[model samples]
Target: MEHILHVTLPEATARAGKEIDQLTVIMDMQGLGLKHLSPSWLSLVGEAVTVIESNYPEVLGACFVINAPPLFSRLYSLVKPLLSKATQEKVQVLDSNYPETLLQHCDAESLPAVYGGSLIDPDGDPSCPSRICWAGPVPDSQINQSKQPHAPPPVIRVALSRSASAQSLGSSEQFSVVEVARGGQRDIPVGFLPVGVELSWCVVVFAKSFLSCL
Candidate 1:
């Protein structure tokens, strides 16, 4: 099956290594026919909805993360309805501010974990901006601990890049698809650090197969 890994980043967090980490994981998951999709907070404006609908036609479902600057609640309310019928029904949106809250509301078995941060460095430092730390197989213990009886295996982590040009650390050999969302109303500049930054937020996408892996 053809799988694609789509990454989205605001202008600010484009250089954050965490974004690369998330994308790597999503790309790895593509083997199972899973596609990862993310929309920028800046693109949550009125007209951008049509753009998303047209561009992401094959997106079976998506996981929305709010990691950038606060968006106008009105904008969030406005653009939500414009989602494609399929996307609206299958999409799962989450808030970076509250990972635990998002976890509690959704069935963990149905999603994959999406994690990223500006602190990670992809280079030798292991602490550079836009660095991807873990892209291959996840630890069995970690998988078992998160698994439940009846649900699918959850995605471990998916990353976002603020800009397509952000430096990417780690091997891109495994990634099949890399998505970038740029040119938006709010330009959030991401920080690139010599050392790794602390991970502040995460969005996990739960899928049925993920549970079987556990």
Candidate 2:
């Protein structure tokens, strides 16, 4: 329910947009909603809804505006007309029974501890950490200082065969002979190969390498 917005574009802008769309679809399917629990609704700027509505309008299952002060009502009225009918319908203003309302839609195990859910007890449990929601922009200095270059993910190389046999040099017995029945395939485990590592080895040429298999 915590709506923590990070106002920074990722390095790969193209992929980030695609990922945002994917996350929107996923959240919509999961019946997740945004909980605006801020004391003041000033943080609910135009940019917040603009990105979501522009990219994946259907992603938002619901929007629960809770703990909004009386001042927010005027602002809300102004913005209500701006939003589409479908989006406006999804917004629920719950002045009281905030926890109970969220419980109706979400399981206790899934809800946060502060909202009467059993996710974790931050005080009693050492592993569980909790914090109050902060709706603000991260300082540019902090962002630049905390930034670190990301490394590419590891590549998993798989060699498939209908039937294959192998025997070590100077060994009498054949080792790692895997066979697959018709309309089926097998995954042969190759020992740990780290990232940026190239594996090259000679294998007995029992069958020609097929592009389809590769």
Candidate 3:
């Protein structure tokens, strides 16, 4: 049976110590969840790839869902000082993109894909108010040949709700969310929105075969 694991950073932290307790709770919950879902399945929360490897060695690849802003703010402080002013400005602009940028850094091909929606009142129909992203069937041959660490499994799909948006991107209808392949050349329509609503972007990732033990 295939396993699905979702990892979320629940708190914003400027220091490692501040995150320890949250991390511990997350890990414990993960273990409990795994026990309930067990036999061949496991799941865990990880703040970084290394943490995932060390703590949940049996897990498949992880889906990182970051909601806090301070995490990036702290990251910017570490690197911005080394870059030129223009470069710094560009980085800031990109930084404002938030969770989308973080997911993209994990894998270039991640796109905005919707996973769930709510039914509008009165008519009791459905409407998508979130963006989704996913990548899958990652290339094994390429992974084996790369000098960098093996890539995670393809993200089949990830949906971000309207509440997740960092800022108003204008009316939701104005921005149509679609899937873009790596290199940003192709687009596949996934969902739609009304004339004035926007959604937080999300990424779907795929896990490598070896990482699938969990």
Candidate 4:
């Protein structure tokens, strides 16, 4: 899962890493491969991996990237050189031929029905007997509870400038949907300024190319 940027990663510590390592061992008993579908994998940004490696090093035993489209290969090549040898060895990229690979790691019954598994995909055909197979981390109480709709957050608009190698914006600027080509980077000023004012912000990615902070 892509982390909400505002939710800070836990500070790196030997104890925390040990706890995560223990959890990884438990997940190994039943398998915990991440089955990502195509197109969505394009949103797998470098910062996400950095967070994982920095705070929870060696937590993932394997990563099953399934059903990646042709363009995924180009993206992979662009990033392959940047990944460490160990990290590269842990990733298993699969194309349409993913069922067999998935079965090798995950049991058919535990797999999602949309991927030819016994369990129904939550977003699968509604006519199926058990379409809503998973409800995720939301508890049943919260799911069944009735709540009033909350007001939406206000949107901020900003002007952007294009330059070679990197894109930039003023500290006061806020923007969305600025596409920086593969291998390019951008710099935007952010965060608290009054020495120790305890500032916080959140980044929500509404689209593959869109990012907004509040």
Candidate 5:
């Protein structure tokens, strides 16, 4: 949130000749969990919305939310009342097949390859890690406990492996980063080796999560 208000807004402003300009926002809600619906979380969203509407009204050109689950609609319902009519009109919930829709507003060269764009990271990463800041997992200790415990909040839950990162163990192996949609799973094909031959794989769930499986 701080990054969006401080860094993103400033960059967009400068790009628009130092005046506030319309900006497009694309959010990947791939790993949204039940914790996101808590009152504490919702209030933080309310706070951000308040700041944006009060200070930067009509700054959004369009806001695209890709890879969003059905539960996201419920979350939006709670937030709908907070948004002005113009801002509400700008919000769009899209499926994983958002690349084609987004291409209508942006050129393929202007976007990263992960979003069906031609621009790929120099390190061969399609997700373009250098251009986008991927979020690391948050720790339980850092989580804010709800202060208004008496107030009831709607319940929701989801758990699905959306993607995986693989490390090449052999010189002949080629690998690249890819994003999987919610409720979608990616299969990494492993070739059959002779009885005398050995094969190895290094799968990283996420760098910050420190989870891996062979």
Candidate 6:
């Protein structure tokens, strides 16, 4: 980060000879999973995001977070409040259709074919292993095994008043997925929830599993 701020930025700006130019930042979080939510990993990521947004607000032209998985929202929310409003406005979280959107901002040749662009690796690898590094899931060797396995938090039943925006009328809410091991069951006590309240949820299970909403 220090090298990028002092050396990379200066050299790139000088080569381009454009005072108004800015760098485009792209973050792809396709394979991020529960394992990444470790305290140490989260702290490091939060600090980096806060520092870049706070210090180099002007250096970034725009930020595109593409191929965002379901858990990305929860992770992003942790750091979103720390960023300035200007930085927030520059960020766009996109789904699978981001390839077309990215092409609109830059030339096809500028991007690698792996991301729906014309650029290709000399060795015919679409991901361009020679030029760009692709990050994979963390190996067991690096993960901290000290995390205490705690039960998932129970959901709160939010009863809507007449003035309250109807859940149907409101936009979709982001919910995190909880994993249940074999022969294990987790309960979300909502039997007493008022009639007016609606509960929306999703569950992800491994092979040969079932869910009982009751």
TM-score for all models, in order of appearance: 0.28, 0.40, 0.17, 0.40, 0.57, 0.58
Against the reference, the lDDT scores of all candidates come to 0.39, 0.51, 0.34, 0.49, 0.71, 0.70
- For candidate 1, lDDT tens digit of each residue in 1-214? 0223333433213654443212211212223211212344345444565865676455433454444333424444666677766766554444555447445544443223443322323343432325345444677866646444644333222233332222342234322223434443333344453333333222122244441111
Tens digit of per-residue lDDT, candidate 2, span 39-69: 4543465556665566556656677776666
Residue pairs in clash, model 4: none
Model 1 residue 107 CA deviation in Å: 16
The sequence of per-residue lDDT tens digits that candidate 4 reaches over residues 6-41 is 232232233246322211111111122244334455
Ten-residue stretch with the least lDDT total in model 5: 153-162
Output the worst ten-in-a-row residue range by lDDT, candidate 3.
24-33
For 102-195, candidate 3 gives per-residue lDDT tens digits of 4433332222222121223234323222322122345677465756875453322323222223233334444433444444544434466444
lDDT, residue 69, candidate 4: 56
* lDDT by residue (tens digit), candidate 6, 58-124: 8888889988888989988998888888888999997788889889876788678878888878878
Write the candidate numbers in order of decreasing lDDT: 5, 6, 2, 4, 1, 3
How well does candidate 4 match the true structure in TM-score terms? 0.40
TM-score, predicted candidate 1 vs. hidden true structure: 0.28
Q: Which is better, 1 or 4, measured by lDDT?
A: 4
Cα-based lDDT at residue 157, candidate 1: 27
Give lDDT tens digits, candidate 5, residues 82-106.
8899999999998767999899877
Q: Which run of 10 residues does model 2 get worst, by summed lDDT?
A: 21-30
After superposition, the stretches of candidate 5 with alpha carbons farther than 4 Å from their true spots are 1-20, 138-214
**Candidate 4: lDDT of 33?**
21
Return the lDDT, model 4, position 159: 38
For residue 57, model 5's alpha carbon misses the true position, in angstroms, by: 1.1
